[model samples]
Target: MLHAFLAAAIPNPGPEAPPGLGDLTNTILAWIKWGCLVSGVAGLMICGGMMILGRRNRNQLAIEGVSSTVWVFGGLALVATAAGLVSVVV
Candidate 1:
């Protein structure tokens, strides 16, 4: 049949990774993970500072700081689960 001929014409080479590419990718991923952690911590600290400064009178800053905490935590959660998520999808 035409379907069989077409299937035969197309060869399926599943998942070919170049040599050393995996190692390079892993190194990059590690760097990114560390960067994410550092940034997340810095973001939390900045948010805390904002809340403290705003507590005196500027309620808006305090509210903004509180809301920003959620975003920081969300980013941390995503970073923490990134590997697992990739594995699940792949």
Candidate 2:
């Protein structure tokens, strides 16, 4: 994807644009694409971790530890899903 964009991005240097000039918009778009890719991967990992964590015995562990782990891991998974969706949209 980046390769195709870069291929076409070769500037037509003239009075308007200097030699070797490239579009800033493409740079910004590339950053956004990279960020979204990272977000999706991170979300996937979080969901995987959540599955492992959900299988663990919470109550059988300790009162405080169980409660906190449940809330934290659950919340993290939710946030990860949301981020992944947002990345897809943007």
Clashes of each: 0, 0
Name the TM-score of candidate 1. Answer: 0.78
Q: What is the C-alpha lDDT of each candidate?
A: 0.92, 0.59
Clash number for model 2?
Answer: 0
> What is candidate 2's lDDT per residue for 33-52, written digit by digit as tens?
67766765675565555555
| Candidate 1: residue 53 Cα off by (Å) | 0.6
Which segments of model 1 are wrong by more than 4 Å?
Answer: 1-16
Candidate 1, residues 1-90, lDDT tens digits: the string is 999999999986656569979889889999999999999999999999889989977999998999999999999999999978986776
Displacement of the residue 26 alpha carbon in candidate 1, Å: 1.0
